[model samples]
Target chain A: MPALVVQWIVALVMLVGAFFILLASIGLLRMPDLFLRMSATSKAGTLGAGLLLVGTIVHFWDFSITTRTVATIIFLLLTSPVAAHLIARAAYFDGVPLWEGTRRDDLRGHYHTSTHTLDSVVRPAPDTEIPEMEGDDFPEEG
Target chain B: MMLDVLWSAILVMLSAAFVLAFIRLVRGPRLPDRVIALDLLTIVVMGFIIVYAVRSGQAAFLDVAIILALISFVGTAAFAYYIERRV
Candidate 1:
């Protein structure tokens, strides 16, 4: 490929990556609740970072840089979901209130706060009617 | 010249992102919100580092990006653990 074409590709990739990162931050600021913000930031942030790294690889076109970029992207892909999960689980147990518009909570009655264990038996089967659990069990804030 | 302009534009966008994430960090009502903001901040900074590496033609800075990624994950996990135990 021509040098000019390659430069354009690099620029385009970097621009998109920066755009995603900006979107993620905006979501983080504008989302209504903690879980919603986590969802927005984790996914968008990881993709943005990965794309930025890929742009670096293309710009350099060096074997060592490519290896490092691949490694970094892989590490990011592997760790981001885990980190999001950990933080979400902690937030849930910490009793972070769900948004008022949240329609259903699958873990509502199944989680045992005392033992930090979930009772699988309490999970509603797809075909069965879900028992209406009391919302008063936990505090809800708008 | 075109690449230079694009690079500077990207840098500006990433800086704006950093500031937005920082606002969340400061305005977050709860600990987890703050933690998530910090995590996003770190990721945005990583993007900045990658852009800098490309613009400066310094492959060495890529290593710093990698290290930042690792450290941010560790910090997030530690904060999660603390939150879980505290409550």
Candidate 2:
């Protein structure tokens, strides 16, 4: 590719990635509670870093750089969600407060308060009855 | 020319994010909040290091980025474990 084209692509990708990072930070600041902030940072921060890595690959375009960047990307994708999960679990066990409007927490009834472990017997109740057929009351007109 | 412009623009934005993350780090109501803020700050710093590597045309700095990312995740997970289990 031409130098100008590569530079333009890099600029655009970096711009978008940087914007996501900025948004993550803003969300971190504005969110009401720890869970929401975790959501923002985990998703947006990982995406932004991925985008920036893409930009780096485009700009550098070397054998070693490509390998390292791909490794970094994989590492990021694998770990971020797990990290978020662990943190959220810890927060829940620590009784970190949820946002006011937050309604249904399925885990509330499932987790053992003393042991901090989710119990298997406490599953969510399934929908018992399907809605009655709306238009099936009438027999075939034949 | 375009790369230069993009670099400055992104640098400015990331710096702003860094400052906001710092505020969260400092003004936390709980330990978990502080941990989250530290995680965010580490991510932003990783971004900064990656950007610097790109700007300077250095592949070595990417190693730093990789190490930083891995270490930050481990740190976050360890903190989570600490919060969950005291020992």
Candidate 3:
């Protein structure tokens, strides 16, 4: 393809991608309900980031980068939903409460409430040490 | 070349969808709402990437889209797990 034509095409791609990102941010800011908002944010953010990076790959047009980009996109699709699900579930458990007009909470009366205290809400247990980062702090190694 | 033009049109449409989704994200009332909106943004990003790949005729560009999708998913899952944890 002519260099000029390629440049124009890539530029347009970038332009559209950026607009999508802005929209995603807009959704993050405007949604009214917790669950609905998360749904919008998760999908839009993932898609927007994916689009931006893809534009980068196109602008470069190299095979190695292409492979890497493809892998990343797949990864995004795989993980985005799982994380979204976890967050939604957690928010519900933490008693964030559904929107005022919610007609139903499917989980209501369906699951048993847990008795375990959630001390790990903000930080992990101090005794649960991380691997390797323990470094010379490990007396045996020292 | 024909596909390129067609895809550009598609991209424009997707961009509009993105705007609608964003309005919802902003109006949300809680942290989860924000998080979810962020996640949705990630998806819209993926679509944008695809359009780039198609428009530039750089099929390889799809690779970045794949990776972004994966990394963001991990971020969301970790956050969710943390919030859901009982102890």
TM-score, every prediction: 0.89, 0.87, 0.58
lDDT of 1 by residue, B11-86 (tens): 8889999999999999999999999999999999899888878877888999999999999999999999999999
Model 2, chain B: what is the TM-score?
A: 0.91
lDDT of 1 by residue, A1-142 (tens): 3388888999899899999999999999999989999989999999999989988889889898899899999999999999999999999888888887676787865766666787876754354333454455456889
lDDT of each: 0.89, 0.85, 0.61
Clashes of each: 0, 0, 72
Q: What is the lDDT of residue B60 in candidate 2?
A: 89
| Top TM-score hit | 1
| Candidate 2 chain A minimal-lDDT segment of 10 residues | A125-134
Candidate 2: lDDT of A120? 67
**lDDT of each residue in B1-87, candidate 3, tens digit only:** 754565566567667656765665576555566556556655666676666675566766566666666666676777677666743
Question: Across residues A13-127, which tens digit of lDDT does each residue of candidate 2 receive?
Answer: 9889999999999999999989999999999999999999999999988888899899999999999999999989988877776776665455655766566767867643352
Task: Write candidate 3's Cα lDDT for A1-142 as tens digits.
Answer: 5376766766566566556565655655555567766665566656665665565666667788767766666666667677767887778766675555565444543333354243423343344332232223224633
Candidate 1 stretches with Cα past 4 Å from truth are A122-142
Pick the winner on DockQ between candidates 1 and 3. 1
Per-residue error for A43 in candidate 2, Å, reads 0.3
Better of 1 and 3 by TM-score: 1
DockQ of each: 0.85, 0.66, 0.27
Question: Candidates sorted by DockQ, descending order?
Answer: 1, 2, 3
